[model samples]
Structures are given as C-alpha cells and as structure tokens.
Target: MAPALNVELAAEPRSAARSRRATTEWLASVCGYASSCDIGQDIVLAVNEAVSNGIEHAYADEDGVVTVCGRIEHTAPERRPDGAGPCGAFEVCIEVSDNGRWRPPAADPGHRGRGLMMAEAAVDHLALDKGESGTVVTLRRRLGCPVSAS
Candidate 1:
C-alpha cells in the first residue's frame, strides 16, 4: 500500500499555509530521496493554490470545511534504452475539496483568476470539478526516481 495523507480543516486563510506544511512534511516522509527534487516543491505549490482557492472562493457565504488528500503510487518500471536497468517512476496525486457552494468569479478579477493557470504550470495534470455541493481540484504528477533494490 502507498503512503497517504488526509487532512480536513476549517476553510480559512490560515488553512492554505497549514496544508502546505502538511503536504511538504508528508511528501518528505513518503517520497524518500526524491522529496528533495523540484517535483516535491511543485506538488506543494499546486496543493497550496488549490486549498487557497477553496478557502477564498468556496465559503463566501458561510462556514465550511476543506479536505486535502494525497497519495504516492509506484508505477511499472521501464527498461532504459541503453539497457542499464529499469527506470523507476512514481505518480503523486493530490485532491483538494471543499464543502461549500461554488461562487462565480467577480466581473473584474484583479490580480486573480490565475490559480488554475498556476496550478497547471506546476504539475503534469490538473483538473477541477465543481458541483452543487462544492468544488474539487486534483493535481497529479509522475516523475522518475532511483529504483530501490529489493
């Protein structure tokens, strides 16, 4: 089974930073040596943006909760072209959801509306689902890693 992180917190300004810290620490614990690379930082940044969007846009009328879930999965290793060995790879998936109504952006979004763009830039895949209940932002990235000997 892969390592995972599930955190639910109040939808507030501080929740973004809290999620960032939690994700950073969790990645370090599960990703091992690869956590120091740029992919780790990219994952954290994308997660932070998703959480911040939920807190800022989702709970405009009332109090609500935000949930951040993350997991790392090892994929099938591919043989290198040079026949050196198998090249290991892993995919990290993180979902940030909020239990609040989705609010349409203001007519004139000043220095805003860039959350999705920024998130897309940081990860390999980004998807947003908005429904009557709330909104969910998913970030996924696959990166190469050193293969561990069994």
Candidate 2:
C-alpha cells in the first residue's frame, strides 16, 4: 500500500481547516493512484469532522498538537474456519489524535457538538479513545480493491 500519510499541526481553530485540506489532498492522491475517487470523498469528509472535533473540543483552552495519520490495508480473501466463504477485504484507516484532554461538548443547541456524529455517519467504522492524556478518533472505510502494492 501507499506509505502512511502523517501530519502534525498546532491545535488552533485555523489548523482545523489546514488539516482538512492536507487530508483531502492526500486522499485525492491515493484515489488517483487507485482510480477510485468516490470513496476518497467520503473518507475526507469523515476525517475533516474528526479533526474539527479535535481542534474545537480537545484543545479548547491552550495550544497543543494534533496528529493525523492515514493508512491503507489490503487483506487477501481467506476462508473461514467454519468452512465459510472468504471474509477479508481492503480497507483504509484514518486516525486523528490530539494531545489534550477531552471535554464534553456544550449542551446548548447552537453552541457546539455534532462533529463526531457527522463523522460516524460518514465512515464504516468509528472508534474513540479518551483519557487524561488526550483523545484519539479513528475512522475506517472498506475499499473494493487494494490501492497500492506497498
């Protein structure tokens, strides 16, 4: 597969947009390489939402760092132990992490929240890890074919 895409940026409001653009470009490159752009768009939207949440909620007070990483995995179809058909397929994973504490979004209807919800709706799988140290959001989307040989 293509080398994992990585970016570290200041956890500022403006950085959210920058993160989105960088991720979009990387996804576009991967899609172009694979001749598949439809899925790339979905991945980009999900990643943007995750990054926005990191910048707005995770680092609400002081400056910190947000790390974005993208990777593609190609799994060859393999028979199941129960004599079932092959079950594995290709997938792309995107992770957006911030070295800042997590805070629940405001309850006000117009104040904040919704990024995670939007991200969840856009991706096949979504995972969230939160603790005193920081929060990490991972989004995964299944691909029809391998994007690269790696």
Per-residue C-alpha lDDT of model 2 across residues 5-74, encoded as one tens digit per residue: 8999887778877876787777656555633366766777888888877777776678888899988777
Best by TM-score: 1
Q: What RMSD does each model have against the real structure? A: 2.8, 4.4
Question: lDDT tens digits, residues 1-150, model 1?
Answer: 445889997988988889988998877776555355787888888998889889888888689999999877677777877998877467888999997887777798898898878989999999989998889999998755652322
> lDDT, candidate 1, residue 50?
88
Candidate 1: list runs displaced more than 4 Å: 33-35, 76-84, 146-150
What is the C-alpha RMSD, rounded to one decimal, of candidate 1? 2.8
List per-prediction Cα lDDT, in the order shown: 0.82, 0.77
- Output the worst ten-in-a-row residue range by lDDT, candidate 1: 141-150
